[model samples]
Target: MSSDEVRARVRVVSPRTSAARTRVTSIASEIDDQTRLGEVYIVSLMRSQLRLAVGVLAVLAVTLGGLPLLFHLVPQIGRIELFGVPLPWLLLSVFAFAEIIVLGWLYVRQAEKNEDDFSDLLEGR
Candidate 1:
């Protein structure tokens, strides 16, 4: 309570030092039981998932963004008619959705794989 008393106490160990000694049953157990190593595993898994998501998004953005540039660079493609509509319109309506579907498939596959990999690691496989 007093400055002199507190200085005299001079605790050598942190109060939270005991928390690091808590042991987890296994990865199948509750997350609260996770030790520092387990926490690192979870953090790495999360980072991997985030990286996959960002990579998918970046690819999609580049693919979609390049379309207009392609049209502009090769103006003849814009004049090409498909079912009485400009090629760009057909591409925008058709290819855009197709690209989204493909990207969604890729994302789903990668996400599931990531989850499976994390699960296996946690399970001590």
Candidate 2:
């Protein structure tokens, strides 16, 4: 072959370098870190909310369970009249109102606490 033809036919191939590999590794690590952090934050919030809900449920169960027992033990109290209605009716109405208030308060408080926790997590705290 002629010198010009030989030079023209010569081909150069670039080999994969360590720096490129390191760059890809670093990017993957950063993505993994972000994904793990996000998962941890979600788990923490869910745990906090679950704990709060359990506490609220415990309180509600105690109060609601005691109402029937109280009425049973104190029949006179349940039979007594209040504003032309039986005392039991009044008690039930009041209990229902109180339950609604307590549940609403618990829900609001839990939601706020969860929001705060999530905010803190996002803020890297």
Candidate 3:
């Protein structure tokens, strides 16, 4: 056949959807449903844990933020030396380190707990 005629014939043929497209759409919908369901199952647990974490941080911020003001209001307290540093500075530094350690420990513990729950869900336990 002439190239022009072959091209015209090809153009006349109906376009078909590939099997891959259909399979992909099907899998995408399945994943969407599973994700929605999993969120429903896990969201409350996650929310409560997040709230606890936020509360801890909030308390830490309030306490730490008040320190400088406390020092200013009562200069005598601030003047007291600990390890050759002012009491306020030493307390603030120690509290900052403690906050980091506490947060890290809590995050690891919560992550492990959440992963265990997710594994159980995935295994149909």
Per-model CA lDDT versus the true structure: 0.81, 0.71, 0.68
**Per-prediction TM-score:** 0.64, 0.54, 0.54
What is the per-residue lDDT of model 3 for residues 28-118, given as tens digits with 9 covering 90 to 100? 3444576664465567557756776787678777777777787778889967988898887777778678977887787778767876775
Score candidate 3 by TM-score against the native: 0.54
Off by over 4 Å in 2: 1-40, 81-85
Off by over 4 Å in 3: 1-31, 34-39
- Per-residue lDDT of candidate 2, residues 32-106 (tens digit): 577774566567778888888888788777777677888778777866897899877876788678886979887
Lowest summed lDDT window (length 10), candidate 2 = 22-31
Worst 10 residues of 3 by lDDT: 22-31
lDDT (C-alpha) at residue 16 in model 3: 53
lDDT score, candidate 2, position 107: 89
TM-score rank, highest first? 1, 2, 3
**TM-score, candidate number 1:** 0.64
> Cα-based RMSD of the predictions, in order?
10.4, 14.0, 13.4
